[model samples]
Target: MTTSRTVPSVSVTYARNGGSTKSNELGMRVMQERAYEKRGEQYLLIKSPPASGKSRALMFIALDKLANQGLKQAIIVVPEKSIGSSFADEPLSKFGFWTDWTVTPKWNLCNAPGEEGGKVNAVETFLNSDDKVLVCTHATFRFAVDKFGVEAFDNRLIAVDEFHHVSANPNNKLGQHLGEFIARDKVHVVAMTGSYFRGDAEAVLAPHDESRFDTVTYTYYEQLNGYEYLKTLDIGYFFYSGSYADDILSVLDADEKTIVHIPNVNSRESTKDKHREVEHIIDALGEWQGTDPTTGFQLVKTPEGRILKIADLVDDEASKRDKVSAALKDPAQKNNRDHVDIIVALGMAKEGFDWIWCEHALTVGYRASLTEIIQIIGRATRDAKGKTRARFTNLIAEPDASEEAVTEAVNDTLKAIAASLLMEQVLAPRFNFTPKTPQSGPVDGFDYGEGGYDPEKSNVGFNEESGQFQIEIKGLAEPKSKEADRICREDLNEVIAAFVQDKQALERGLFDGEHAGGETLPEELTQVRMGKIVKDKFPELDDEDQEAVRQHAVAALNLTQKAKEIAVTGPDVEKGNTALIDGVRRYAMDVRELDIDLIDRINPFGEAYAILAKTMSEESLKQVAAIISGKRVNLTPDEARELARRAVRFKQERGRLPSVTSPDPWEKRMAEGIAFLARMKAEAENA
Candidate 1:
């Protein structure tokens, strides 16, 4: 029986995994209702298991929130365009006053010359409507400055779908984009997803700027806490961390009626690494190898030098959408009989993938996240009749292989599961590809049309005539865009916050309201001050330095000079800001200044070489100096003198000169060094 949770039904049908919505299957009613209602309580997280239906639940909540005065219009930034756009029409259309449009431009516009991207169309449409709801791909929403220009995608109510996608390591462009966008109070957003694989926490938290979320809720798929919604399905899984396919073959050799799934390999080791390990597992199966033990089909018999092949083991290259859609339907795969027994896999076939055929799974990757560990477990929770929960086994290479590390891995996996579950409170309907029909009545009002718009000012409105206050978004780029302004919003607000705290000073004309009296805040000092104030104000804002009013002043300047220098290398803006600040901090208060360029007697290579090459490898320069003097290859004094005084060329030539033309790479380098050295000697002699 399904728990109370209610996830949305795709064109596909879903038997409740385990967790059910507490009441009415909308908005995580039982758990998060109180938190949502109160102010300063917008950060509670909810956990939902795989197939627990979090997407649909969150969709309903988002729709319900649309009715609020705070959320008349909103933007959902779809990480994967295919998944988010699939449900854009119906559930969103339900709000009678809000219009929803998917902003992923349908491909294939060869015939139309004037079309831009889906972003352009969505904005134009939103401008035309009275109540606008925009759903766009991360590309369109995240890269607005480059794609549609800055003015196109600004929205007060915004939701970044599948936030976990932006959580992996490395400097991220999307995370930076979303972080800056979501930091505003006007934008009421919910980051939706079912995967929260952990990376460096500091980097991950830096992007969401968690302080901005009204509520942060978390739930775990394991232990089935707030996400008891997923427990109804018999959760079965196999664990085999650090175990080879060969090891698992040994264990599964005795079983029949099993379906094994594997993913395609990409690395250089792909062809041999895992395959070689399978051979070892086959040998370990001993007497059970290839005897069917059930139908007597001898499916896993090991030949002298061969590995065992389990029945129904296939590799599908398509994404979870196709693999899942197909697995959900066809029972017979690749000449295999209906009802697969054991599923084996790697890579894409691992966690986050849904496969009903899998009754038994081996955690062979040695080390995997807890979310991965549990996702593999949650895979078997389908409640199909006569479908028994598969047994789970973890493959371990050694009896005591760093239990502490394994424990941490499992804990992290569990934490990720909790994160995904909580995220599901908002994922269910949004991931809905196809909506089901109401048995009796017409649901026409379900497709709510946005009522009106003012494209120029991003003026939002819906049911204003009925006393409902709505916000509108302007259609085209303006001379001065809101986003450019919003980028500095936090800094401005913090300074304003400090100003509010000291309102008495403000009324006293703190050096004339418009202008500051103290010499304009030093470029470096402003940043130092701003970062300090902001850190003091919210303490939770991730990327922003929290000094009260200094950050505001720095933001006023188009990024400090230090900030510009750091940008040239392209890293997180805050890192650059910090670097700039640090650099400024290092400058001595009572400083010793030195001129970088001091004219000494020009180097032996003459002033010409000095000017021609400001910087080069020591060896390369030696070659240049040698070439001028002919020191390495004997030359007459007249020859050296002529080469030197005959109007030596002066313009600076960046980088190393042709080191040498020798056939050998190393030889060329050596020869060039000697030649430059000789030239330098000649220039010195002439000097």
Candidate 2:
């Protein structure tokens, strides 16, 4: 049997306050109520976690638009037919709302039996008719918009669900069409998404277009913290060797209600024969009894003599798969915890697939898209009675030095690390940073540790009710422009997503320390690398604005890492929901003062490397380090220019240029950058 080792990258505990699930007088949950308050805005974006009632939120807003806002109609656009069911009719009046959300059966194109191209006539018919709401897939809407110009859909509220599917890339038809509609300025638009950033590093909307929309953000910390159940959520990955089927039992607990996503046929980890793999997994469990006729679930008796009802969605046979799919989606059984034990799927049960009792989400290989990973994790995050813990596990193949695919395996490993880092930021509490001036004081709602806020040093204050951290860092660059401030408040995660995904930055940060040639200074990645990424991501911003964003993003990432290190290593490992909060306070108290320079000196990936050492085999770890170290890269001209810019800032503040002989590593690195850039200019002049 192949050995299986799993390490949880992030295990967050929540408060279980039950505030999110509780509804207001209008029967709107916390997030939904917040979104409803902004219904008057013509352009709005709802960024909330899954199972946070985004569908109901849209219903509340869409109904208001129809009855009160004087809008002609509401078009709900979803990425797939499965997600289209989210916009189904709701009896809002029964829940204290003034009106109901109804989409006429004929106008619900998702349930209709025709191709998207053939649905254009229905869209035209609905526009000409008095139907208040229409629901369809993104494909159907794209085709309809192509057939009918932007002018044809005027005076309507177009609500896009899974908004991340629409990209700012010119090639993205839906995104292009949405831009056209915004330019026309004739219709109202509302976009909702569980994850705002895409895994492929593309913007969902252009800067100017995104700025037009008033954003309503409900972070994962807030959503999970306010839950009635699911107190802890663990995100982890396992590395396995040889066929995954042989090692499946190591991580796949038969007691937990899990959804195992087998690898795609094209993925390197796949054995190429999916059917055989499924049979192997079943056999590994125990004796297989006959299939249940009604649910079409395969009955397998585990070693403990308990029968397991597993839904096999990997089968290509349409009749068999459809029966299993129908049974899984049966609304009557949604609340029944024992309805299904495990689900083995290939491409289904990811987006919009709801299984509230799922204790774990397990996948065989690394998913290329971070958005996909987030959605898969969401499947297990639903709050169910007695289910206090939910976890997501990724089973990846370990790299082998003898294999030709070693390089490919290394890339997958890096991508998996990137995904873990991004998820950590997403799951952490929201950070509100401010410069530490002489007049700095504690915010109104925040709790400033045991001794209260200090006047002489930086303070870390946490507001449990708001699920936010008010941190005062000395020398933190404050954003001047409104747009820059908005980004620092709302889009720091998006900025971090780009930074962690950078190939060079991730490579160096992960494996280029003492094991490799030279030690990578924290400022090299935090200042020069992140600075370049921010400038490229938002070219519209001025130099000062760009620096402000860079500082904020770096501080957020590094502080979280520092906090996690303290929490995990501290005596009280199970500190419950307040672990992170306590960790931050402890870190602040341990240091003399919290400053931007001290924060930048921290390697954001240090905690990650420590965890990696504990989980991966020493030999395999060395192999990965060797593979990455083989491709040692010199500083590029772009990096040199970015560092030189930093050197200039250093000179302005310290009254002298950074010295190569300086004891400080950051100062020496800046001096080296200046030398590198000067040498390049000299060589260019000679050429």
Candidate 3:
């Protein structure tokens, strides 16, 4: 399978320190602004993308906490030695910060040579001192906590970088120590990470612990969109049947600044010959000249007779590593793309290794983890002076002979493609919702006064105001005058909520489960079953209101089916463009070019609104309209029943009455539910 798609980049403006401040790194400024806003809080978790200025954001906040706040000291913990450089000495005050960020030479434990005991000793040395800030690797901190105990960290703020390294599993040493610290309540923590989601599906933190954190999430879309220079990033996969080493240059340009990652040695496709792979790429480029003595970059003459310099990061020789490292790090080589035409890496250069001039990240073979894919892509995302766009291409080998292997390969590829699709949404600018004025004719899917929302009318619209797509929900009918009102009036959420919350009902309604009357339902949610479920869920609603919701519900389900067919199956069945490998057809599509207009035409709120709109009814719509208009609605018996059910469930689970003042949406819902129930109960007692 081979395909390509443009990664959409959106631009943004952000305020720093509550004042409008412009900087070269828009991602940094945005994070700084958010951190500055939450500086008063004890624990701050910044979830951001790679190269999104998370490290610098931590520096800004930690410095403030140590100097201005009553925090005694700060410690920056990193996962690896390579990543420790991110926290190296920086002149923050020069960049408009209040103070400079420094890690004393002796206290910086990254390059410190020692066993666990030596690391422990160095940690104790730093802890006993009155130093404002200290930097160390994760292993050093783990040993220090075990050797000296958690008591040593009291009154200190622990800023953990690459926060995802700590897992919820009790056996994860770092996580265990973190749990102890949280339990003590003496230490303040700032968790930072480019990738927060665990690839292994393990919880990053326990639920109760995660709740206490004041999280500031900055997405990839915000970072890339706000870039001063970087505009587009194209990610795609190229499939081949032969050895990747022989076919790599077909997709990778030798003239471009590129990093070529050789397959893992343990994998079946691995040649176990990094030198051989390098030789192949070198031969494909042209004749290799002897290495340059002044800068260890190997010079190669291309077929066009162009001289290209290549850095071999996979070489095991110490002397070669030193010379190459020096050449790559030399100030003269910075932003000089011609000097480093290609970097051949086996395992290094995935994270925290900065090469601002890199324009192409070409990897040989599949990366099973999505987190790694994002990290590898980060290598080429840095804002370079002249570079406007970057590209990531994966050259994967097609699966051979075995049927099981073929199935696995196809499934993994499909999953990767799906992930890329979702990532595009994550990195794209969010749509802003607004109330649509009642139209004389049909507008974007909605017809005012008729309570009609057609899925076919939905679409993705680019707005000049926000420089992003706007999801236009047309129509102003029934009561409330807001986009959410249209969603509620249709009961889109209600139908979805009912089926989702009840597995048996969902199976019966959508997946052919046995009914009470012994009638067998269809394997999929048909229009007939949808109507019945919608009616059953809203017994209190009148026929007219119920009918409108039912129609919307059916429309939503139909639209979902249509989308699945068009997006997933249509291309394969219609175009016959899929490749047959080991008897399994591998479908390739450029997900980045997905028709957002087509996706937009379908209302996400249709089914959900259909569910919620049922019970909402005419009178309930008035109550909702009143709420939207900032007017209060006195509780009635039916309203009371809905509120009571949710409230009782909340109290039963938590062993206490849910707070009416809680800012949590679920808690507020439960409180309202219970309030209505209480009112109805009171009326019943009087009767």
Candidate 4:
């Protein structure tokens, strides 16, 4: 009894919780609480998901600094005019905050009609006066800065929302202005953004500058998984053979609250006629009741004579623009918020536009950017009164082999699929892990050779009571090497999977590209000789990329070996489990949904190894550094206990165990012994 729409969709699954509404009443939300904790820091970057209350968090911190911390002024800058409303004044006391957030109407220069000079003059007036908060668009801020210069706003707090608009490129005006502000060192900055990681896939700030700020990341998982009403969000793709407008009726629900985005004007798939498409959809719905003047809703009569209300944001008339925008925001004349059935928009409602009742966000075209897709998806994720679930459906055209643009269309579709998979990874819960057991010596029957460490030999398990996912690894210094090994192995696996999946991989001749016909190597020699072949094949790749290919080949060989070895262990032994050996440690994966396919699907940011290398957490960096420094060891219980006894004896004899002032060999050894003893005791107690 399932329909065509249900059959063609791919299910997107992720971890979620029952939901939380503590923030709905105001005061400080979970994320805002995190911000308030870091209020004392000079530079703060709040990386949070959209609709997670970053604006209110900034208000709380800015007010605290302006009223109590002696900051001269606070300037709030947004990327667009509609976003400026997010900073509108709020009665804080009613919401349990100490003071109200006040923005004078005169200083709020968003969407004010005039040229660059007029906006600059307005900024000048605000700066000259005693206004504590001035809100303006990023364009206006740029013009004002050009006219008044950076020194005019010295000692003030500049809080930039949607901080991803800034990038390393010199052509990006806001980015350049932020760099200058950082260089001057006169202003304190609080940069906030929902799309900080993937916008343009470019550095938002220079490495040295980005390092100066203390960052607080509120992941998409934390926000959605903690919601009170909404439980699940499904992101799926539906492909059609013809025009999206013609195929629209197959996937869209007329009864559901939905926003339908037509194809971009420049897209090859676009008919270049949005109005006709709108008309076609309206005709399919029912009879036309004409536009309602009172509420600005376009009323239509269905074949059943049922009237359907639509908000036509694509209307080009300048006069209707304001009315349409207002109606889109509220959509209710007498508190009937859900009166509008469908909102057909061109480009108006993508970012920073809040409509709480939307249940479906439908887009008809390929958008290459993952950041843009995430923003579009966020529109339907807002928790509402009766909304229990949400969906994001992408309607893309399937490639036609007979068509002239088939090659390009096929490539674009593959890229979109890759981006969708990557988004799932980003939105899903991350795995965080620490060593659960101390490393023991090498186990019997286990081999590190090409035929040794197979999938069958690998041991992985989940402890329901403790909520831990455990994996067994070889060698003692396992704790120190766990993170590095996991990262290297996973990254290498991804590269190999991409190599196998991509048609371009063979066309590029990644393997045997430069090799001429010669004597065939033996089957066993193929694995042994693949690295040199890969390195020689892609000579155009830089040293790093070349090295990655070689690493991928090696990793594939090792994985095959593991799988074979695990097979030899027999079916009686559980998968992913091996007998405990000396120098082996048990590690726990803190992430959920660890899948090989998911790992391979992250398509953006060219090399997986490079991205992981650049974005490792401080603790992970320390672990990697320690492993690289060759300082990790597998200590036995006897050794750990003896070290502890010796440390105690030393302290009693000398009144102090060691001194960090000097790099003396004996002091360093004593310190290491004492630390190892403490670690062993802690491990034993936890066990």
Q: Could you say which candidate leads in lDDT?
A: 2
TM-score winner, 2 or 4: 2
- Model 2, 514-601: lDDT tens digits are 4234578888899989999999999999999999999999999998998899999897588788888898889988998899999988
* Candidate order (lDDT): 2, 4, 3, 1
TM-score, each model? 0.41, 0.99, 0.65, 0.67
Measured by TM-score, the strongest candidate is: 2
TM-score of the candidate numbered 1? 0.41
Clashes of 3: 28
Off-target runs (Cα >4 Å) in candidate 4 are: 1-20, 24-26, 331-335, 434-687
Q: Model 3: residues >4 Å from true position, as ranges?
A: 1-21, 24-28, 402-404, 431-687
Q: Write the per-residue lDDT of candidate 3 for residues 1-687, one digit (tens) a residue.
A: 122222221111221122112353322376567776787678788877777677888888887788888888898999887677788888877766667889887777887777768878877877778888888888889989988899889988999988878887988999999888888888899998776344454556664565567778665655665666676666656555557777776787876789888888865456887788788888888899989887777789988988888888778897997789778777676767666778888778887778988988888767765567667888887777677777887765554434345534433433344334333334443333332333322334321222344234432333222223333334311323232233333225335434333323332332122221222223123323343455575544554445445444433333333332343334443222110110011110222222222222333323322322232233433333232233223344544454454466457768987788897634664576577666667899999
Stretches of candidate 2 off by over 4 Å are 514-518
How many clashing residue pairs are found in candidate 4? 27
What is each predicted model's overall lDDT from 0 to 1? Answer: 0.35, 0.91, 0.59, 0.60
Which residue window of length 10 is worst by lDDT in model 2?
510-519
The lDDT of model 3 is 0.59
Stretches > 4 Å off in candidate 1: 1-47, 65-74, 85-141, 149-151, 167-170, 195-197, 200-203, 216-218, 221-243, 250-344, 350-352, 356-358, 367-371, 381-393, 399-687
Model 4: which ten-residue window has the lowest total lDDT?
Answer: 579-588
* Residue 478 lDDT in candidate 1: 16
